[model samples]
Target: MTTLNTHPTTAPATSAAGGGGSLRRVLWAAQILLAAFLLIGSALPKFAGQSDAVRTFTDIGWGQWLRYVTGTVEAAGAIGLVVPRLAGLAATGLIGLMGGAVLTQLLVLEPVWSLLPAVFAVVFAAVAWDRRAESRQVLRSLRRAPSRTP
Candidate 1:
């Protein structure tokens, strides 16, 4: 009888030699910290209408409503980032949001200002890519679920 190795391979590649695995773990820790910091920092100010956030949004010429929408989205993404099962989806959402932020800054703010959002977009993209396999598994399982149509 033949047996299959059914163990799930959900983790990113990590070399057991030369401390490469430890390095990967460190990088992942930094990524999580960066995501939490950026998202929460962006979200809270908009929710509370802090002076800096309000002024920046005002300069963008969009109504205050945009601020609230962005804050809520950022908060949601931040929460999702810490959840093991949802990090990939959260990172994906953050990438799109940060892309919009970068474009807005490019058009309405100093060119240098756009770089911050652009950096966030890149980091989020990396997170999404690292989790791609897990995300694919999640997608497959969802697809296999029975539809609830009456």
Candidate 2:
């Protein structure tokens, strides 16, 4: 379906490719911005052993190792978000991670802390939704690949 733009500043999608391209660009921008914020604000601190990260992990009683692991995953996911084909998978992983964060906050910490992770999860879900076709294609390719068994 083509999208009709009322304003001259934005051109309407003339074909399926054009519509998909426009949508993809929009989703890509959103994913990049979100990934950058997460990587810089959250992942770097954990990797660097910042006081706040240490304190939060200590409070959660999960040990400092989990913080490092979380940081690594976040960094990887953020990197994946910038790759056009990997954005959906990246967002999917982040959604799972954020869901766990939300649960941990709700169970171990105050309710207020849970809100942020919950919000992040929602945004990740949106990215996944927008890239559903690409994600499904990847999955299909994986499923159809020949086994390497000797």
Candidate 3:
């Protein structure tokens, strides 16, 4: 089906890619901004052994290794968010990360700090919802790929 503003050939089976190009652009922009923020404010610090990251991880009682692991996931997810095909899946994964962050904040750090992850969770949910079609398409492709095992 085609609307006056959209052609089936030009659009995908997704809202983020089809009917509302403008919205998709906004979402992309948001994702880019968030990824930049995560890389600079969170991921990089952990990898760099910054004092704040060190302190936070120490407080969490999960050891420095957990900091590295969390940073790795955050960095990967941030990078994934910018890849058109991976945004949905990345957002879905980030939502889980954010949920864990929220719980950690409440239980380990400070209760007030949970707000950040909670807000991130909501934003990720929006991106995941918007890109659901792309996520499904990727999954379908994986399912259709021929097995390589001999």
- lDDT per prediction? 0.77, 0.82, 0.87
TM-score of 1: 0.79
Which has the greatest TM-score? 3
Candidate with more favorable, higher lDDT: 1 or 2: 2
Clashing residue pairs in candidate 1 are: none
Q: Please say which candidate is ahead in lDDT: 2 or 3.
A: 3
Clashes per candidate, residues 3 or more apart or on different chains: 0, 0, 0
lDDT by residue (tens digit), candidate 3, 1-150: 875755333665346545576777778888999999888888999999999999999998879999999999999999989987889999999999999999998988899989999998888888898888778888988999797997
Off by over 4 Å in 2: 1-23, 147-150
TM match of model 3 to true structure:
0.86
Query: Per-residue lDDT tens digits of candidate 2, residues 1-150?
Result: 997666522544222234566666776677888888779998999999999999999999989999999999999999989875677889999999999999998999887889988988887887787766667768888999787987
Which of candidates 1 and 3 is the stronger one according to lDDT?
3
lDDT (tens digit, per residue) of candidate 1 on 34-126: 657756677887888899999988888888889899999888888877765666788899899988988888888887889988887887776
Worst 10 residues of 3 by lDDT: 5-14
Global local distance difference test of model 3: 0.87
